[model samples]
Structure formats: C-alpha cells, structure tokens
Target: MRSPFVQLLTARRFAPLFVTQFLGAFNDNLLKASLGIFVTYRLAEQSGLGASSLVMLAGGLFITPFFLFSGASGTLADRTDKATIARWVKLAEIGIMGLGAWGLWQQSIPLLLAALFGLGTHSTVFGPIKYALLPQHLGADELVAGNALIEAGTFLAILLGTILGGSVVLFDRGALVVGGVGVGCAIAGWITSRQIPPAPASVGPDAPRPRLLRDSLDVVQYVTSQSKLLLPALAVSWFWLFGATVVSGLPVLAKDVLFANEQVVTLMLALFAIGVGVGSILAERLLHGEVSARHVPLGGCVMAFCAVDLYLGSLGRPRATELAGAATFLREPGSWRILADLVGLAAGGGLFTVPLYAILQHESEPSHRARVIAANNIINALAMTVAAVVAAALLARGMTMGELLGLCGVATIPVIVITAWIVRRGLMKGVVRLVLRVLYRVEVDGLEHVRAALPHAVIAAN
Candidate 1:
C-alpha cells in the first residue's frame, strides 16, 4: 500500500500547499541562520555583546511580529481565500529579501533587523492560512498524516537551510550569496503558492468585519470558554518554548560547550531537524491514527531525559583553545552522545506538538478556526519570546549553554504535568474515542483468538 505521505503527494490538493509551505520554511530559516552566523562571528564585537546574546535577540525580534499581527492574519484568513492571502504574503517576501540583501551586503545590523521583522510579518500573515487550509482540504482521517507531512517537510527544510546558511557564509562575498538565495527561494515560494487550489472562505464577505480589540477579546473568550482546549493550546506553545531554547542555544553550545565550529553547529541543527521530522512522521503510526493528548506526557518525559543526558554529556568537558571543526568534533569522545541527545530531544518535541495541532484543527469551530490558529501563533511567539529572554538572562549570568538547556528541560516537566492535569478527563480511552470521532478504521486479523479466549469479553480500545 502507498504510504499516507505518498498519497498526499499524489493528490494535487495537498502537494502544492506542501511545496509552498516547505519553500516558505526554507526561506525563513535560511535567512535567520545566515543572519545568526553573521551576527555571531562578524558583528558581536561591534554590538558589544556576546554571540549567543545576539542570536537570542535576533530570534526574539523575528518572532515578535507574530504576536502583533497574528490577530489580523486570522481575520484575513477567515475573510478571504487562504490561497490569495498566501500569494500576497509570498510576493511581499521579494521586497523583504531585497532589503535583507542590502543589509547583508553593507553589514548594516539595523537594516538587517528590519528585514528580519519584515520576514516575521510575512510569516505572521501566512501562519493562520496554512494550518486552516489543511482541515478544509483533507479529511479527518488524514489529519494526523497531513500534519505529520507538513511538520516533517518543514523541519527538513530547516535542516537544509541550516546547512546551506552556515556553509555559504564560508565563501567570499557570502552576504551577497545569502541575499540571492533569499530572493530566489521567495520567488519559488510565490510561484508554488500560486499553484495552490483556492480554499473556501470560512467567513462570508457580507459577514461583519471584526474590530481589532473585539477580535482579540473574542478569541480569548472562545479559548477560555473551553478550558480543555486552552490547555492543549498552551501545551503547543510550550513546545515552541522548549524548541526555541534548544535551537537558539545550539550555535553557542557547539562553540563554547562542545568546542566546535560552524560546521558542527550545522550538524547539530540538521540532526535535531531530522529527528523532529522522523518523530512527526512516526506519530501517525505510533498512535495508529488514534489522535489525542495521550502521547504527550510520554513525549515530554523523553525530552527531559534527553535534556539531562545532554547536560551530563557536556558537563565539565574541557573547552578547547581552538574550536574543533565538524570532522574533529565527530571523532571526539561523547560527541555521539551529544548528537543523540539533540536528536532525542527534537523527536520528543515532534511527538509532543503534532497531536495538539491536530486537536486544534479538528476540534475548533470552523468559523473561528483560523482565529484559533492565530491565537496559537500568538502564544507560540510569546512563549518563544519568554524563552529567549530567560535564556538571555541565564547566559548573561555566566551559566553554561548546557546548564541553560538542562533548566529548560526541567522547566518542561511542570508545564506538561499541569497541562496533563487540566486535560486528564480526556485521557481515558472512551473519552479519546469520543473526542476524536471516527478516529481510526483499522481491521485486526487476530481478533478471532480474543473471541475464542473469552466470548463477550469486556474490551477497552482507543
């Protein structure tokens, strides 16, 4: 049988959206990674701050617009064809990339930051449209698989972007190259966006346009109306907090803790991205299409374990006078363990977040779905911002990157526990079945054995 992802790709409905989203992610990460490396190596001294601090700053800046514009994005998504919104966003990327190109070529930090903010706005505009489009186009049966594919494609794009972003900067006139890549990818994404089939408007044109303050209050009221939904949404946000901490910490972690160079940084990023992608794809099979928050507690526990392992692996290791290149780092003792920790952590993250996205899409009222997604984006952005701020503070206090990550891992436990407690009633199997209507359609071959062992047996299933 063809795999779910294969089937998704074969269908024209899903395939174009996938490519468009993939390209958008690739462009975002490529610009961010390149800017990060530049800030790390070339401009930290001029800025009078550490490279890690600068990275966190850039990350915070890039995500800030999501908080500011997500509500408006949601309004747009609900009000019009999602594909049209996506196209406009992608077209806007061309100008943003041009500004980034100029900023990079001139080594102008302020201009580059402006470009970053612009890119963030671009992403904010597209965020609600992308997730909201999925449920409209795919069946409930395909929700997990569809989301898995998007998550997988996205992180894989991140992986490639990280590698390319770091490698290209090693060349002469790397700034120009980074700028060129940004524009090219944006153009490609826009073209792909054009190919996406039009999505139906969730809100009719004659539907009264919501005022900004009203929109925000309405979303909050809707989210709070169902406290159960609120918890899952927060759980989703916590994933971003956890992920942003680890990813933003990696470059410094590689350089300071592992005593490695950009290539090793690239390796760490790619490994983590790969792991998340694998875990996202596997989530569909692991749960056997039974979508619920049942797997989240386990995933969070695994992430904590990996985080502790990472800390232990790097603790008390000697810092090298000269940074090790990727090859040399790979040969060092404890290198594989560190790699494993990164991968494991990312895999756990993938497991933790996918079900929540499915829940958000499948459970929310269709009329308010995009707005809910926008709420999610706002929460994700705020959580990431908090992570960045906390991480920055911890690093400024002379804490090692490993220790900060360990703290992040530890912090995750309570959030997961609290979220689990809030959604505990849904943890039961029967509740899960009810929560997810027609969750799965699986046929087991060995059912006769169970029947023979005990006729009319009381069986519990998900």
Candidate 2:
C-alpha cells in the first residue's frame, strides 16, 4: 500500500488543498527568511540595525497579523464556503507578493516589514478555512491522517523555504529572484485552490449574518461556555508556545553555546523539521488508522525529556572561539546527542499535536468549529508572543542559552500535567453538557449528551 502522504497527495479532494496549503506555507517562510538574510548580510550598513535585531523584528511583524486578524478570519470562514474564502485569500497573496517585490526592488525596510505583516494576515485568514475544510472533505477515520499530512507538508515546506531563502540571498540580485519565486508560489497556490470543491459553510444563508467585531469578542465566551473544548484549544496554543521558545533559543545555542556557525544552525533546524514530519507519519501508523488521545501523555513526556537532554548535551563543550562547520560539529563528541535530542523532541511534539488537533475538530460543533479554531489561533499567537518576550527577558538577564532551553524543557512537564488533569476530569464532555443544560435547558446526565450534540449544535452563551 502507498503511504498515507502519497495516498493523500494522489486523491483529488485532498491533493489540490494540500498543494495550495503547502505552497502558501512555503511562500510565507520564504518571504520571511529571504528578507531576514537580505537585511542581515546586505543591508546591515544601510538599515542601521544589527543582523539579530533585524531578524527578530521581521519575525515579530510576521506573527503580529495572526494576533490581530485570526478572529475576523474565523468569522469569515464560518459565514461562507471555506473553499471560496481560500480562493480569495490565495488571490490576495498575488498582490501581497507584488508588494514584497516592490519592497525588495527598493530595498526599503518599512516596505519589507509591511510585506511580512501582509503575509501573516494572509495566513491568519487562511488558518480557519484550512482546518475547517478537512472535516467537511474527509471521513472521521481520515482526520488524523489528513492532519498528519498537513502538518508534515507544512514542516517540509518550512525546511525547503528556509534553505531556499537563505541560499538565494547569497547570489547577486538574490532579492529580485526571491521576489520572483514568491510570486510563482503564490500563483501556483491560487491555481491549485481553484480546483478545490466548495466546502460547507458553517452557517446557513438564512442564518443571521455574523458581525466580525462582535463575534471576535465573543470567542472567549464561546470557548468558556464549552469548557471541555477549552483545554484542547489551549493545548494546541501551548504547543506553538513550546516550539517558538525552542526556536528562539536555537541561534544562540548554535553560535555561543555550541561554537558552530550558520550551517550548523541550518542542520539543526533540518533535523527538527524532518523529525516532526517523520513523527507525524509515524503517529498515523502507530495508531492503526485511528485518532486516539492515549498517546498524548507519552508524547508530552518524551518531548520534555528529550528537550532536557538537549540542554544537557549542550553543556561543558570544549571551549573554542572559532566557529565550527557542519562536518566539524558532527565530528565532535556530544554533537550526536544534541542532534538526537532535537529529533526526539520534534517527534514527540508531532505525536503530541496531531491528536490535539483531532480533538479540537471532533469536539467542536460544526457551526462553531471554525470559530473555535480561530480562538486557538489567537491563543497561539498570544502564547508565542509571550514566549518571545520571556525568552528575550531570560537571555538578557544573564541566563546561558543552554540554561534557558533547559528551563523551557522543564516547564513543559507542568503544562502537560495540567492538560492531562483537565482531560481526565472529562472537561471536554462537560463543555458540551454545560451547553445543553444551560442553553437548551435539557437535562444532560453523561458524556453521551455531549457527544450526541457535538456534530450539529450552534453553541452560544447569553
């Protein structure tokens, strides 16, 4: 039998969506990475900002849109056909790329930063539609497999984009070439999106139109009214926070902690990405074609353990002022341990996330599912923002890179434990039950009521 990824890639319903999502992800990273490198190497004198600060600023700008727009995006996804929303978003990407190209041509920092924000806005709008589309298109049994493919494809896209962006920036006129590539990816994504069949709108045409500002403000209330759904969404957000923290620490770890250069940084990133991709596919196989929460605790523990090990491996390395190449770094003792730890951490992360996504989709009511995803996105953006702040504060306060990483690793344990506690108390079921009892005033005695109402109910709180 063909692997799940291959099977999904060949299937009509999934293939087009897959390609579109992948290309979008690819271009997002490509733009960010390319702009980062260009600013760091080529415009350092002109920009008057150090390479590290410029890159950090770019990262912040890219993620800021998600925080600002995901709520409205969720409303849009729920109010219209997801495929239609995707098409429009993809179309917008063409113009966004044009802006980015202009930025590159002019070598303007402000324009480039605006492009980054624009790309992030594109992603925010697409986020709700992408996840919501899967349930409408795929069978319940295929949910895990579908999410696995998207996650794997996304990571692979990031890896390729990062490498391509960094590599292209080395050549003369690289910015123009990068801009050209961005336009191409955007065009390709738009073409693929054209092929996607119309997906169900969460609300009926006769239903009262959702007010974006009002609905966005109500997301927190919606989440709270369905208490069980809250944990899974928070867990998803936490995963982002965890991943961002690790990533934020990497450059420092590669340079100061490990005495390795940029190539080693690339290698370490590649390992993490590959590991997540491999782990996602592996989780699908290990579950015997089912979406189960049983593996989540195991995965969370594994991630925490491996991250700690990574910190330990980074410690007490031989003192050398000179930067080591990839090969030289690999030859040194403990390097393998660090690599293995990173791979293991990423794999564990994959295992941890797939089920949480499935849980979010499966638990949410159809009409509110996209909105729930938007809430998750908002939380994710906030968590990541907080993580960045925390990492920066810790680093500035005389903490070593390895020690900061180890702190984050240690922090994961408590987070996982609290999530597990919430899950065990049957909070997800309780969320549904509470809605039935309070809103519909129906007597709900058990988890059965919650599960029965999950598919069709439009959850709201007075």
Candidate 3:
C-alpha cells in the first residue's frame, strides 16, 4: 500500500542515516577535490615541486593515515554508540578544514600535507563506524537500497566537488575560495550529523579494549576467519588496487603516451566518475536488496575484459603531433574507443564494489562491524600505495601506459580467478546458504517454520 520510493524514505532509521552519510561523503569529496586542484596548480608552482611529485605527495598524505589509523578507528566504532561517533567525527572534520584553511593562507606545502593527513585520519576513523552502523539502522532488506544510495550520493559528491574545484582553481583568489567552500561544507556536514539517531553500541562499554597493534591484528584475524566476509573484502581491496593503478597512471598516460592535454585527462576522469555513479545506483535494482554476491565475479570479469581492451586500444597511440584540444579529443575517431573503455571500466568498478560492500556490511557482526570496515580501509590504502609504486616502476621501466594497463589487466585475471574459485567452494556455499536461510526466516517467519517443519515431517514419514 506504500509507494516504493516513499517506503524507502519513510523507514525511520534509514532516512536520517542516509542524509547523514550523504552529506559526509559530499563534504569529504568537496574538500579533497579542492585540495587536489590547489595542489595541482598553486602548491606545485610555489613549492618548486614538479607536478607529479606534488600529486604523489598529496596522494600519499591522504592515504598514509588509513594505513596507520584505520584499525584503531574500527575498534572505536565497535566500542561506541555510532551516532555519537558520527557527531564527533564531523566536528573533527571541521578542525581538519580549519587546518586546510590555514594551509591555504600560508601556502605552506608541509602544513597542507599535514592537514591532508589529518583529513585522511579523520576519514579513516570514520570508515568503520560509517559502514558498521548501517546494518544496525536498516533491516537486511533495506541494505541494498541504502548502500546504493550511499554510493550514488558519494559519487555525486565527488563529481560536484571535482567540478567545483576545477572552476575555483581558475580564479585569481582560488585558494581563498576553496578554503571557504571547504569550511562551509564541513559545517553543513556537521549540522547533518546531528540528525542521525543513536545506534546502540554492539559491545559492552566496559569491555577491555586491546592495545592498538593487537587490536588491529584481531580485526584482521576475525575478518579472515569468516570466508563470506573475507572473500568480499579481498575482492573489494583488489578493485581499489586495480583502480588506483589505472587512475594514478592516467595523468602520465594522457601526457606521455596518449599525447593529450590536461583537459582531456580531466574529461576522462569525469566520464569514469559519472559511469561509476550510474552503475552504482543501478546495482540497487539489480540486487533487489538481497545477497547478490555473484555480481562480484561478474564485475571482475567485465573489468578484466574492459581493461584489456583499453590496453589494446592504446597500442596505436596517436603521435604527439596528432594531439588535439578537448573538443577535438572528443571528435576524434580513437577518442570514442578510449571513452567507451573508461566508461566500461567505471561501470565494472561500481558493480564490483557495491556488492562487496553490502556483503561486508551484511555479514559482519554488529559489534565488530566498524572494525571490519576499518580493515577494509587499511587494505585499500595499502593496495593503493602498492599501485603507486608499481605504476612508478612501470613508468621508470619505460613501459607505455597502455602496456602497463595491459599488464595490470593480466594481473587482475589471476586475482579474479582465485576469487571465483573461493566463491564456488563448498564451504562458501554452505555459509551463504546458512545466512540466506536465516535472513529468509527473519523475513517470513511463520512460513519458513511451516516449510521446515513440513519438510522434516515428510522425510520422517518416508
């Protein structure tokens, strides 16, 4: 008797959480996009660091915190009321933005990098709470829709932030503009954070907390012990690894290999981001708010295929003399192929990621949910770092971007194959069936009991 959209919206727990999460993502991306642009133009020019070095430094600053703090962050989420944590995290974001504003005023590369690290730390701390709290707030039936909306909102934020950052950087007072916007976004995010209803702690407040190192090790041990959780987490980590490698290499590829300009690179990024956003939203419908773990295998295959095709497409790179403006880049015969590949890769990425995330959220124990997510963030950060190193190595070795991408695609194949094998194992199937049966019982209690009892009685009579 309820409209579908209304039903989704009227769900008490989800509504506030969705708004809170969306704003958080929006703010994060807004700040990150502005910072990325600021680094690209102002920092590199003023600090005497080459553009590449500046970019890499910025990336490193943002990623390092995840490696260092995600585990601790996860534990905190498990130990606290998530709504309280979300509020404090938002407040922390405001302080981080203030530091960013200071960096902008001084144009101090070190300060900016430090602020970036602080921001990353804040994000890392929030990671586990963000994901872990969802299952607490929403029923299993709502998870897919909730996650899809989150993914869509996050991507939309990224797109908006990137566009805003790009526009602001062209201004004479770009730094001031970016700083003001970041501060404003942080404030808005904080305000939204207040609306999130309290989520009860999963563990006892008086439970003895482990030391940091041991706590992190425990998170890893716990997650790895559950195959349903472990496989998806590993698969998600690999997606980030593959993506980081490609995206980090894209600038170099665009300039050195594709012989294209900055605008082209930006456009390609936009295309990929948009594709991912669209694909993520579509996953909601495809998954129907249930366990659609098979999407991971399917997405992995598509990703490998598209990556290989992109590599092949790049084999006949146009000469430097053939370089063109953004308009011409779009109109060129070969450009369409590249664009298609980018879109496909982006779509595949969305398909690959959303399900894994849903599975992680769905399978994790509520108390340790945040810690599990923190582990995911840690792995993602590590994978990205490795990707950067590998990309640099490939570049140093004089491998063309296309060739490097091809190699990455080839590398992904083995990972995907292994994931598929794991997913197909009897143990995994048994676990999945058990989870599904439990969920089904929860959904249709009397009917499930009747079916089970009737089947048992029939077997006894036989």
lDDT of 2 by residue, 206-271 (tens): 754556556666775688678767877777777788887776567789999999998998998899
- TM-score for candidate 2: 0.89
lDDT of each: 0.83, 0.83, 0.75
- Which ranges in model 1 have alpha carbons more than 4 Å from their true place? 39-57, 210-214, 419-462
Better of 2 and 3 by lDDT: 2
Query: Listing every candidate in turn, what is its Cα RMSD in Å to the true structure after a full C-alpha superposition?
Result: 5.5, 8.1, 5.2
On the 0 to 100 scale, the lDDT of residue 8 in model 3 is: 59
lDDT of 3 by residue, 353-456 (tens): 88789989988877778888987787777777888787788778888888887787788788777767766664376567668778775332344355447545
Q: In candidate 1, what residue range of length 10 has the lowest lDDT sum?
A: 442-451
Ranking by TM-score: 2, 1, 3
Reference-based TM-score of each model: 0.87, 0.89, 0.86
Q: Cα miss at 452, model 1 (Å)?
A: 26
lDDT of 2: 0.83
* Residue pairs with clashing backbones, model 1: none
